[model samples]
Every structure is written in C-alpha cells, then in structure tokens.
Target: MGKSHVLVIPFPAQGHVIPMMELSQRLIEQGVKVTFVNTEVIHNKIVTSNWINKDGVDDDLRHMVSIPDGLDPCEDRNDIVKLAKSISQNMPGKFEELIESVDKEDDTKITCIIADFNMAWAIRVAKKKGIKPAAFWSASVITLASVLSVEKLIDDGIINEKGMVLKDEMIRLSDSMLPMKPTNMFWVCFEDPALSEVAFQIVLAAKQASELTEWVLCNSTTELEAATFSMYPQLSPIGPLLASNRLADQTGHFWKEDTTCLAWLDQQPACSVIYIAFGSFTLFNQNQFEELAFGLELSNKPFLWVVRPGMTKETATIFPDGYMERIGSRGKIVSWAPQQKVLAHPSVACFVSHCGWNSTLEGVTNGLPFLCWPYFSDQFQDETYICDIWKTGLGLNKDERGIITREEIKSKIEVLFNNGMFRANALDIKEKVASSIAKGGCSHSNFNKFFEWIHEKDS
Candidate 1:
C-alpha cells in the first residue's frame, strides 16, 4: 500500500481550527500525508499572522489549502447563522473540486476525510467519493451527546423538531449525565429566534450527516466526563490535544500572539498574576469593559489581560479615567496572547475566562482554577462542569442590570483566592489530564488505535 493520505477540515472558527491543526500535527508525526483545509478568509489570516512558518521549518508531509466559504468579502463572517448557511450551500461542491484537483496532482490519493462535527456535510461528500469519513468533535463529549440525541430530546417532548425548547426546564440525557438547562442547549442559546431556528436546522443537518461517519473522535478524556463517554461508547476521546503535549507552539491563530507578556510574567512573583482572556467571539459594551478594567484594578493584584481588537463594540477599547496610570506596572494588556504559555507560567494564579472549550482545556491542563464569565452557548455548560461538577472553579454572578459589576468581579477573586480547595482540585485534575496523555494512558491508547485505523488497508 502507498502512504496513508487524509484530508482534514475544521469548522473555520479559531476554536475548531486549532484542535484540528493539533490533530493534523499528530498525523504528520506518524508519517501520514495530510491536506489541512480552511476557508479562504481563515487561511489568509493564519498564513499572514505567520503561524504556519513561526519556526521557519516546513513539514513536507502536511499541506494547507483553502476553499471558498460561499460568502462575499463584505459579508459578516461573525454572524454564525449566515456563515453556517453559506457553508452548507457552497462548501461541498468546492470541497469536491479541491479533492479532484488534489488527486490529479498527488500520487497518494486521499483515502480518508476527518471533518469537524459541525461540518459533517463533508463526511457525506467523502462517502460519495468512496473515502472513509471520520467526525471530530472539539467540545465536551456531553455536548456532542446532546446534539446527537436530538431525536431523543424531540421524542421526550423536551425540544421540537426545529430544536425549540417546548418546556423550559433542566434535562438529563441519562441517569449518569449531569443536568443541563434547555435554554443552554447549543442550538437555542442565541438570543434571536430566527437565528436560533436556522442554527437548529444546521444542527439537524449535521446530525444526519454524522450518522454516515465511521468514527467519532472527541477532544475530551473519559477522566473528565466518564459517564458521558460511557453513554456513547463510539465517541473516542484523544485529547486535551494541546501543542504543549508535544512541546511545540500552537498554530492556527487568526491573530499574531504577543510574546512580550512572557517577559513581564517572568518578573512577577509566583502565583500572583490574574490572567484574563476571552476567546475570539466574545464582545462587551463600553460600560461592561470599563467595569472589568476597574474590577481588575480593584483586585490590586498583578494581571495579564487579552484585549482583542474587537473585544468591545466601541471604536476603541477605552479604559476608565486614569486607569493606566493608576494600575501602572501591575497590569499587562495585549491585543492577543499566547494563552497556553501564559497559563503554564508559574506567575499566573488563576483564569478569569469566557469558558470557551479551548480555554477550558488550557486552564485545566495548566492547573489554574477559573472564574467563569460565560457569554453564550456551551460556555454555560462548561462552567457547570467547572463550578458544580469538578469544584475547580467559581462562576461570576450578574446584577439586576444584567451587568457583571466591578464589585462582583473583585468579590469573586477574593473568594477564589481565599479558598485553597479550588487550587487543590485544579491540580488534581491537571494530574489526571497529564496521565491520560502519557504512555499506556486512555487517550494515548485511543490515539494509537486511531493511528492504526488511519493506516489500515481496504479489505
């Protein structure tokens, strides 16, 4: 048999792209040929940001390619529903064309397709071309279970065919699974009813396509969600798929990471810095932004904050009056940060996070307790795991005005810091995560099996 060649595609968002890239890296290490696909926009951002060539060494086994997402240049990519619609309408044909072109150029024809669960349509495309299809889920196993259980949810009268929650209540998929709010269901979390319905349709399509997949790989471990993994025995966990596990820098970042913060972190005392970062999609109004700034100041502890370019809706991220001067050298603010390294820094005490899955895994692996301030979708579910299930984090509460005030932030910091159990629990979870990725561990064994499957010849 010739070399095992695979085409890997992610859902085009940063959170999805990063883990898929990490998985691609593992494939490259095993001497497999990989074609990593991204949308044109995402491809440009990653290449221009210098992430692909950061080390100045290119891997011959891996190739990065881009396909149109079916949106015009001026279209708003941030609108999830619109992006989903465009991708569903346009990508399959473009993807098939790319595969044909690739086959004409490369001797090792594409043998398999590994697609993000959200982009399961590609699995059908693979099947049409006589290629093996595998689904990759970058979020929690329970979240995947929830999406896959759409029919069960509908049969139970919890949600309708369109994913609308008929009854507003908490639900448990099984006796062993944790309870989840209907409003927190991934499809229904959007505030706009129309958008929610569209998202529901996209999810339904994904579920149907996912049924054609031969393997379902998840970026989680049984140690973290034992019951959920046990409930769906087919969903294989081969993660916390971090670059740190291989001692490499992470790739697939849309923004260039500022490494200067590492120098500043070096100067701080051990476990003294409050690290705050919300992932790419989070946005805040000016009032809330100022409250967060003031709250960090109120803590009076050293801090490192990732204030992304569009973090706030305002034209500029305006801080409180004289805020920079008042805080002085105690805080470091960067547009984007190297989060994995930042969390691994000994000077960092805990995470004030938006609870995105990538951030959750990064914080947990680094043994940092969390102050969860989730914005939307799956984030609330992750917070439940952190605060309620694992007891390794605390959730920040909002006031009657729907604002998380400076006082609330300050108080949570105080409460989190005053308690030692949170840190201890975090450390314990960290150890389990490390063990899972080590030799003879669950994730390690699963990954080995996946590797073998990827190389297996057709009967």
Candidate 2:
C-alpha cells in the first residue's frame, strides 16, 4: 500500500488559509500525507514566523510549499484582486510542473485536491489528469448558495452593465430573509466590461468547479443551514469544527502568540466584556473608527478590541482625543491577539464583528452574542443568518454611502447587552454548534464520510 497524499490550496488570505490549515491537520491526523501550497511571499512570511513559535504547526506530518503567485510581492493587499486576476493566466503551468515534481520521487498518487472556492483552476488541472478536485467553501452555506446564485442573477438582468450595481435603495434576493443590495463578490462579481472580463475569467474558473468527483464542501454545519443543505445535497456541510466548548485549535498563529489578553480577561467578570474584531481584511474609515471608539466608550461596558495595523489609512487620527484614557480602566487594545483564546475567555460576553465566517463559527461555538457589521463578499449573508435565522446576533444598517454612526453603534450595543432574550438565544445556538461537532454528531459523521471517500476511492 502506497501513501495517501492530498494537495490543499487556499485563496491567498489570512481567514482563508487558517481553515484550510485546520482541515489539513485533520487529514494528517487520519493518516493522510498533505502538501499545503501558499505563494512564495506568504510562504516566506510563514517561515520567518516559524522561528518565533515552533509549537504552532507540526513540521513533520504536514509541509508548507510555495509557487510563484505571478504577482509582484511589492504590491499591497488592496491590490491583490488585480494581482490574482493576472495569476489565472500564468499559474496553471507552474502548478502542473510542481505536481509533476511531487509525483516523481513518490509512489503516492496525487489522488485528490481540496481547494478554496476561489482556486477553481485546480478543477481543470485535476481533470486534465485523472485526479479528483473539490472546491471547499469555508463559509456559511448560505454564502456558497449566494455565490452560485450569481449566475442566476446574471441571467435575470438583476445586474446592470456595472455588474450587479446597487441603486440607493436596498435590493432583496429571494433567498434572503432581509433586504440587502447585491454588490461585488469582492471583485469577481463586478459587471464593468473590463472588470466583467476579469469576472468572466473567474466564472470560467467557478463554472468548472462542479466537475470534480466530489462536490462543494462548506465549513458550516447542517443544523445551521438546513434550507441550504436541502437544496444542494452535494454541497456537504461539515463544520463548526471546534473541540467541546470552543476549546480546540489553540496552536496559535505562525508567529509567537501573546497571551496578555487572556490574563486580562481573567480579572473581568464572566460574560461581561464585549470583544471587537473585523476579521483580517475589512477596514474602517476614520469617521467610522472614531464612531466605534466613542460608541464603545458610551456603552459604558468593558471592552477588548483588536485594531490591526492595516485596519485604516488614518488609524492614528481615527481615535478621539483622550479616548483611550476615557475608557482607560475598562479597555484593552492590541494590534493582534490570540483570537480563538480571547473568544473562549469567560469574560467575553458579546462580539462586535465584521461577520466573517471564521469569526462567526468561533463566536457561535463559544456562546458569545454578536453585533454584526458585514463588509463584503458573503459577509452580508453571514450577518443575515446570524441576525435573522440563527437569532444570535444583530445587524448594523448603514446609510447610502455605507456609513454606520456612533449612535447607531451605541444603541445596538445597548440593545444587545440589555436584552437578556438575545443572549439566551445566542447561548442556545452555541450548544447546538457544540453538539454538531461532538462525537457521533452530524458534522463529525460527515467528516468521517469524507475521509473514507478519499481513502477508499481516490487515494
């Protein structure tokens, strides 16, 4: 019997990479060999960080490999979309070559690929050979359904020459319980002829995604999105992948993780602190930043905020004068903190979030309630599920220009904190999330099924 090997690739970003890493870890635990591919630039960053925290990842069972992303490393993150567009034309041959090199010395066949939804090129590569490829959507199932529905939207002319342009009025989708104007699927959903050309290139990539032997795999659990799962049985829901009580994946980041915040949380009362983060990529303008700062202060609640360096162009000027001092004793701020640890802390009561899926799962698993502020992509959909279907979170309604004010922030926080009803509901859902990931649970069973499929047929 030869070794069972799988290649795992994620869309090049922080939130996307983390879940793929978790899934890869699980595959390794089940006795499969794994190769995780990141761009050279991202790979270098991980390597430097590896020296700082040797315990973060198992260097033996899993290996990190790199390929040229076909983009200049000098470009900033905001320009990543344009850079990614360029890669579609260039990376296929490079990736095929890399696969050849891996196959040369080993008896293991490149049996299957589990790639991010954005990495649709892998489907073509897998099909060109005899291997299998499956797209993994590390988000709520509603989001995957929404992205798939974009083709339906295009056929309906809901999108204009601008590619799903929104008028000042909110446009509602039939799948959505609430009204939300359709916008960019971050950049791939645009309709501008030039951008649509890029978008069409992506659709060219996405449409081929279903050609894989296995179908889409989402990180959400079935109980959370029963309607979505019922509609697309092929889109398997195997997630909320946390240990009991959100206690797992404490391996920390590629970099040395600081635990000062955990010590700080110990002194706070149980479920009394509001934890605020905007996932990895969402950014705020100065006005919105000050508004959030003032709103948190005005809410008169103890709060912990993760304000990353890339969060704003004018981050230094965004905070109000004496703002840190005004909330001095009650506030804790860090450029970055061990997020999973902070979310699981006893004092972390509520979350003010950008509604990214990873954070959504973490919050639900921990039983913390939410104040949802969605930015882009499927975040709005995640927000809808949190506030509407899940009954665990509240959404922020922005104006025509998408600006949310301090008063709105303060009012929502007050409503969330004072409403014993909301907290109870959030906690109730939390228990369900925990149960689904437990032994003999739905997600657990689904994972085992996936493992067996890979081993018996593909591997």
Candidate 3:
C-alpha cells in the first residue's frame, strides 16, 4: 500500500489549530503524507511570523495548504457570528478545489479529510468524493455530549435565543451527565437572533458529526472523560496531546511568543508563580479588569499575566493607580508569553486559565494546578472536569451583575495555592498524562486504533 494521504483542517483559532498540527505530525511519523490546511489569512500570519521555517519538513511528505477564507485579513474578529456564518456558507467549494488540485498532481489520493467539528462544510464535500471524513472536536467530550443535547435544552427551556438559564435557575437538563452553567452551553446572550443562528449552525454541524463518520475524534483522553464516555459511549477520546516528545521540534504560534517571561520564571522560586492567561480570544470590560488587578495584588503571590492590548477597556492602559507598584518584584504582566514554555517551567506552580482544551492539556502535562475562570464555549465544561471530576482546579463565581469580585479572586487563588489535596490531585493527573503519552500508553493505543479504523474503512 502507498502512503495514506491525509488533509487536516482545523478552526483557525490558535487553540484549535495547534492540536491539529500535532496530530498531523504524529500521522506523518506513522508514514502518512500530511497536508495541513489553514485559512489564507492565518496562513499569511504563519509565514510572516517566520515560525515554520522552509526547512521545517521534508521537501515532500508534508506541506501547508491555504485557501481563501472569504474574509479580508483586517476584518473584525469580534464579529464571530458573522465570521462563522460566512465560513459555513463558503468553505465547501474551496475545500473541494484544494483537494482536487492536490489529487491531480499526486497519485496518492486524499484518503481522509480530518476537519474541525465546527467546519461542517468539509463533511458533505468528503462524502461527495467518496473519501473518509473524520471530525476532530478540540473541546471536551462532555461539551460535545452537551451540544448533542441541544434539542433537549431547548425543550426544557434551559436555552433560548436570548440566553441560557442561569446556574441557579429552575430549568433542568434531561440528564445530569452534562451538568452545565448558563453561560457554558452556547454564546447567544446578545439578544440578536444572528448569534443564535450562528450557534445553530455550530450545533447542526456537531449533530451532523455523529452521522458523518464512526471516527469522531475529540482532542481529549479517556482518563479525563471516563464519565462522559460512560454517558456517550460512541465518541472517541484520544487526546491531552501535549508535548509528547514529538512537538518539541515543531514551530510555535503564528505570532512570536515572548520568551523574556521564561527568563523571569527562571529567577523565581520553585512552584512560586501563578500563570494567568485568559487565552487570545477572551476579553474583559473595565470593571472586571480592575477587580482582577486588585485581586492579584491582594493575593500577595508571584504571578505572570498575559494581558493583550484592548483586552480590557478603551481605557485599558490605566489598570489602576499604583497597582503595578504594589505588586513590584512579584508580578510580571506582559501582552503575550510563550505559554507552553512558561507552564513547563518549575517556577510556575498554578495556572489561572479559561480552561481551553489546549491550555488545559498543557497545564496538566506540566503538572500545574488551576484556578479555572471559564469564559465561553466548552471552557466551563472543561473546567467542570478540571475542578469537579479531576479535583485539580477551582472555579470563580460572578455576581448578579456578572462581575467577579477582587475578594473572591483573592480567596480562590489562596485556597488553590495552600490546599495540599489540590496539589496532590493535580500531580496525579499529571502522572496519568505522562503515562498516556508514554510509549504504548492509552493515547498511543487510541491513536493506533484511530488509524486501524480508517484503514478498515478504506478496505
């Protein structure tokens, strides 16, 4: 048999794209020819960032393929609803063209199209071509399982076009298998039907996923989602795909990651600094910003925070009067840091994260406990596993006005830092993750099974 040619596409966010790249690399190591596809805009950034060198891969065997994303590079990233709608409408034709053009030049036919579960357009195109289509959901299995429960949510009035029911609300889901908070399920609170419509498209895509292939792959591990698997047995759990020794040589993100923070970490005491990043996509308003500032100051712990410009208010520059001076020599806040490197540092003790799947896996792989402040999407679900199931993280509460108080923030950080049981639990998950990524571990076996399923599909 010739090389099994695979085209891997992921949602063009930093979190989603990174794992797919890792998976692509792993497939290539298994003698599969890989083509990693990103939107043209993101691809341009990848090139300009000088992250992936021309000599990064063999002259053959692997390449980057970028097609039109139907939006200009300067378009608004905040208009996620619009962006998602446009991509859903337009991506199929471009995908078909890309696959056809590649297949025309090489006899190794496109054996599989592994795509982000959000990118539903690929499935129809793959079906048309008589090729295997595998959907890779970067979120947790429980989140996907919850998403599959959307109709039930609508029926129970747990979710509506305006917003979901609040955590303390009377509405209940059909099963406690995917217990959820209001903001956790989907982002439809803007009172605009457009957001809900966009959300519907995402759900449609996920619901259709169960129909598209038997090989629905999630970037999660069985160790993490034993409960989710017990609830929904059909889904595949092959993830927490962190360093795994293979990604050590791979390129970083499309933007240059600041390494000075690592130098700062090197100077701190062992397990001393709190690593805080809400991820690249999340932003806060002014009130929330001020609270976090005072909270971190009051915690009296060494911390490193990545605060992007415009991440808070129009007056984002004015964090607080003399706040930085108060935390002098203890806190280092920058725009963006090399996250995986920072988390891996021994000086980094805990992670205050949004619980994005990629960051969660990175946190676990580095043996860092968490202060889980989830923002949107499946982050709350991931946080549920981290805090509730895995006993490795803690959650923050918002007031009636949606503000997380400085007092609450300070308390949670202190608890997570001082609690011995939290540390022990985090280390246990860390060791489990280590073994899973080790040779002939559970993830490795699942990966082999993934391939065997694909080959069996081919045969």
Candidate 4:
C-alpha cells in the first residue's frame, strides 16, 4: 500500500460513533487515510452537519461511506437488543460489498479493518477479503474487562453462559474487580427477563469479537485502568480521544447543542454550577424525573442540566408549576448541553451524571468530582471506582424505595462543594489524564505503536 489506510466501522450509536470519529481524526494526523463508515441512517443525519465541514476530516486524508444497518425507518434504533439483532444479521453482506467496492475504486488497497467490538462478524468479513481486522472497544477498558470475564464468571458459577447470576450473591471476577450484586449489572437495570437475555447475547457477540483480534484499540488510557490492562495484554489504550480545539467546533453532535448554555455558565459564580447529563441511553421514570427536578431545586446552586427528549420513560418532561420562575436564572436546563464545553467551564463545580464511561472520563478530564447515581450496568462498577478506588467523587445512595430523592442529590452537591478533598483528587487525575494524551505521553506513544502495526504487512 502506498500509504497506510484503514476502514473504520463503528456500532451506530452516539457514544460509539464519536470516539471512532476522534480516532479517525488521530489517524489522519499521522498520515493514514481513513474511510469512516456509518449506518445509512446515521450517515444521512450526520453527513451534512458534522463531517463534511469538520476541520480534521480533509478530502485527501479521509472519506465517509455508509451501509444499511438493516433497521427499517420505523424501528427504534436506540433499542439496544433490536439494534444488535438487526445489524448482526443483516449487515454482513452489505459490509462485504462495501469493502470490495472501496478496494476497487481506490488506488491504494485498504491495509486494515477496524471494527467495533460488538460487530464480531466484521473480523470474518475482513479475513475473507484479505485484509487485517482489529477490534475496537469504545467503552472503558475496565468495563470491557468485566465483559471479557463473563465466561470466567460462568465457569465459576457466578453467572451462567447467558449472563444470568446463579443466585442472589456478591461476586468478584478478580481481586481488582468491584464486588457486584447478582441482580444489578451493566449500565441499566436488566430486571426485565426478556431484555436481560437479549442484552447478554450482545455481550457474547462482543466477547467473541475480542477473541478474534490480535490488535485492539480502546478509548481509554492505561492510567485509567492499570489492572484491567495487565489482565488483557492485547488491548492498546489510546483514548480520551476528544476533539482538540481545532476540531472542537466541527465535531458532529447527534443532538444540536444549546450554545446559550455557555453564556449561562458565565453568570454563575466560580465552582458553583452542578452539571448534569445522562448519556444517550439512560431513561428516567416519571417519578425519577420529578425527583430530579425537585432535587435540582433543593440544591440552591447554579446548574446546567441536559434533558434530551425520550430521556424519560413516558417522554413527558413537564416540570412542577412555577418551576422556572421559582429559580429564575439560577438554573439552566437545555435539551442538550455542549457537554465537553460545559464540563470544562470554570464555574462548573461537579457533575451529577449517570457514570457512563464517556461521561466518567469527561468528568475526570475536567477535574470535576462526580455525584454518581448510576442507573445501571457498568456504571455501578464505575461508581465503585470513583468513590472507592479513585477517591475522586461521592455516590448518592438510593432510598428505601431504590430511588435517589431530591435530598440525596442536594446532599451530594453540598458534599462535593463543602469539601476540598475529592475536588483535589479529581484534579490530580485530570493532570494524569491530560499528561497521558499530551505530546510524548503514554497514549501518544501507544498511538505510535499502533500506527507501526498499521503500516506493517498483514500476515
């Protein structure tokens, strides 16, 4: 190949796509050509507003292509189980055709195929086409480690092959792993038996995908998950793959950000604003939603909250009567806030987040402590680390009803602000994270190592 070139395919979701896009930009910076592929639905939504005018995606360095995800227009793309089933079954042939067409059209043969860990079938497709394939896990390596250990969990009788816990027991995968309850796991409550089984199948696919790859690129730093990295020697941590200042304005958003939030932050006193946003998938019950609103009101602190539509169970986001006028300018709520921007603002004291891996990393990167009210899955795991291992944040305990009341929210915000200890710890992690992604840092060196592999002849 004249120049190292790779085709990057991400499982179509906001969290997954953004990091892959960032990785593409990084590769472009290192003189590699990238054909960034997306599902036709996502491609059509993002093509105009995001990539075309984005600074890092230049004509000569990178290109965009899309294939059908096999989801009908009427289907819910956010339905995790359905999305997994449809894409896994329908897209293999379409992806194979796209790869063939790209090879035929480009003078330079594609050197590598980097696919999301969820898309295990891509490895087979790549092997058939005479290209190298690598797995990319977009979440925290720590979380992926838990996932990769599911089989071991089954072997030890902690969980079955289907990821069902054998009984109501506390289980530990490794000494470094957090103690997990049998019932609550991953990012959300899998209380629904049907949903849990389907969710487990997706994890099985991701694990199989991991075993097939000799190379793996993760959107995390070794500093973030040292023990996890030691356990899995193949994973290469080269992330916190944020869009730098040059690409910041251009990086695409699945939802339009309310730019007004920036000005709102300006009016708040330093370190007085609490920033809240649950990433793409966390849904709140009507009770949870009203409680969150009441909690924000009780805090008496300036805040910015991102409430995306469909975030609530019923899609009803109505506030209590006189809710806006009561707080006036003290609180600002938007359908979507420019999260990276809001977190980095000087006035933002802490984050009331769902503890999604991306949100966790962003909070750490910004030196802000967390109010961890994890809704489900690996988030509960992440909360253990933030509160126990890292000592960088406080988690809100659920009430007798298993709900985090307004008082709990208010209390956590007070704890983060009234105390200097956790804030100091968060800043320390921030320094380490920033240094890792900086020039001559660990992630940068790892990126070089990864690039060297990309340039090598395929076996």
Candidate topping lDDT: 1
Model 1 has a clash total of 0
| Model 2 lDDT tens row, 1-459 | 556788888877777777787888788888888888877766666666553133333555576787988877777645655767767877778889888987896567688888788788877787887777878887777656645666666666665543444343444445523455555354433334465556545654675676555757778887787777777778777786543333345432444455687888999999889999887677778878887888889888898998877688663645788887789879998877778888878898899998988888888888888999887777877888888888888988777767887788889988887888878888898888778878888888888888887887643
**How large is the C-alpha RMSD of every model relative to the true structure?**
1.6, 3.2, 2.9, 2.4
Candidate 2 — which pairs collide? 163-191
For model 1, name the residue pairs that clash.
Answer: none
Model 2 poorest ten-residue lDDT run: 243-252
Tell me how candidate 4 scores on lDDT.
Answer: 0.82
What TM-score would candidate 4 get against the native?
Answer: 0.94
Where is model 4 poorest over a 10-residue stretch in terms of lDDT?
49-58
Query: What TM-scores do the predictions have?
Result: 0.97, 0.89, 0.90, 0.94
lDDT of 3 by residue, 331-365 (tens): 99888777888887889989999888888988888
**34-144 in candidate 4: lDDT tens per residue?**
999889888776755454644424479788778898888888886767887788889999998888897898887888999988777887788788888888888777678
The C-alpha lDDT values of all candidates are 0.91, 0.74, 0.78, 0.82
- Total clashing pairs in model 3: 1
| lDDT of model 1 at position 180 | 95
Q: Higher lDDT: candidate 2 or 3? A: 3
Candidate 4 regions with alpha-carbon error over 4 angstroms: 48-58, 182-184, 187-189, 247-252
* Clashing residue pairs found in predicted model 3: 220-239
Mark the 10 consecutive residues where model 1 has the least summed lDDT. Answer: 51-60
* lDDT (Cα, 0-100) at 145 in candidate 1: 80
